[model samples]
Target: MATFATSDQLLVIIDPAARQTDGESVRIVKDVLSAGAAAKVCLPEGPEEFARALGRRGSRRPVVVGDDRALVRAVTLLHRHRELAGCALSVVPVGSTLALAQSLGVPTSAVAAARTVLDGVERRLDLLVDDSDGVVLGALDIPPAPVRAAAVAEPVSAASGRPWLRTTYRSLVRTLAPRPPRLAAVPAPGPCRLRVEVDGATVVDLDQPVEAVSVTPGSSGAAEVEVRPLSVGAEATPLRASGRTVTVVGGDFRYRADALVSGPVRRRTWTVSEAAWALTLPAHP
Candidate 1:
């Protein structure tokens, strides 16, 4: 059984942009979390500063006091440092943009989110790592979408600076349409051939152009490879498969994986190693 560290300190990293939107709620969360345990708060000037802050994250339990992108940024930073294993993490949903927290089943209310610190359960989940060495603790693959500045997604990291526009747009649209698991399919100008092999055995090979491909790697050389076909205004659908090694080939086009974009590469692959990371949740649901 996993045990919580009794002396672990909750290190709160606030998103500067979110601060403008939820500063009071953030302070309330910080003060609540600081009741007994030590709380250290820092405002990320932007994405780069956010990465530097997390890179220097010491032995403290990371407690992000922002929205999902903030959580993604910290998780990416931790995965980049290969510290996802050593560090246990927490998040407070202090923004109107709360899709990430909802996906993880974290509460949206500041008080409820803070109570997660005491009652949340630890769940070991797969972290998606790509061939280019991108570390994503959340969704890894997204179909292509019209190029909107961070308007569609935000990188798990904040390098391009926190995606305030993405956050705002997401919030507005979510209220109007609410984020549906079923997302309209982005147009695919051409076909993408995906050749998938596991343990040296071919699983899926196609010449049809796919709208998008997402790869999520588990810590144990296992991953979920999803292939979404390009259909006009198609809804989001998951193509789920688990494997030791997954490779995507033959696409002279670009696509979005969560919050970032990778160019028209010939192919890409992912290898999941045997180390698991956990998220704070009641169940791995």
Candidate 2:
């Protein structure tokens, strides 16, 4: 655990998406943070600038004002530079998507999140690091889910009060809407044969076709893995295991890590880095 003084210097990096998504909230966050601490704010125009700003943060603590993707980008950049273990990060969730931040105990409101940044305590967290140097802050799913098309709505004019509200409403509707029933004539997706290994032991092999696979960083310094195999006449039970390392081998496959999707690769491996990073959250959260 780590604690910060109110006078601590801060490197506040505002993500471009946040500014565009909710300028009012972003301004509120900036105002609150500036009033609470000695902060240097950086308005990066793109990912390159974001990385550079974070890399040059020096000794000041980093406080990201954006959504889940921005938080993931900051963590990934720091992890790539081997600086994650030494730095504690803070986030002020101020964008259209904030599930990751909220799930991690971050306050959703701009003023509340800003206060958390000033008065929060640092807590070390686990991470899933892939062979390709990718990091997953939340969960990882194999065979990435198909992206859903958003419900079409009339474009909000300048008279609209808040664009973010409209966006949120659309997202809520999408979430609560019933998924279309699969047609009986159309065959379900056939499972892919993949070899999954946990630690050094094989949990599933190519002999068994699997419908899906999921991996999440466990609280006990390991990875919780589940493989759902395909069954002919009976429902197949998911094979589950926990280990420090997980490797999957098969034909080209894709995976979803946090918010991004990657691969069409034949093989991939992920290892658990116990308490590999730290994040600042509300002191009592």
| Alpha-carbon lDDT of model 2 | 0.88
Candidate 2 segments exceeding 4 Å error: 1-7, 149-190, 231-234
- Give me the candidate number with maximum TM-score: 2
What local lDDT does model 2 show for residue 135? 96
Clashes of 1: 9
How would you encode candidate 2's per-residue C-alpha lDDT over 222-265 as one tens digit per residue? 99999999877998888999999999999998888887889889
lDDT of 1 by residue, 1-285 (tens): 333365446667888867877667878887777774666677889999888777776776677888776787777777777788877778888765576577666878888778776567776666656688765554555345564223344334343455786687667766887554655655544546666555556545675446566665544557766676655675656456778776666645455555556677777666675445666664333
Q: State each model's C-alpha RMSD to the native.
A: 10.1, 7.1
What RMSD value applies to candidate 2? Answer: 7.1
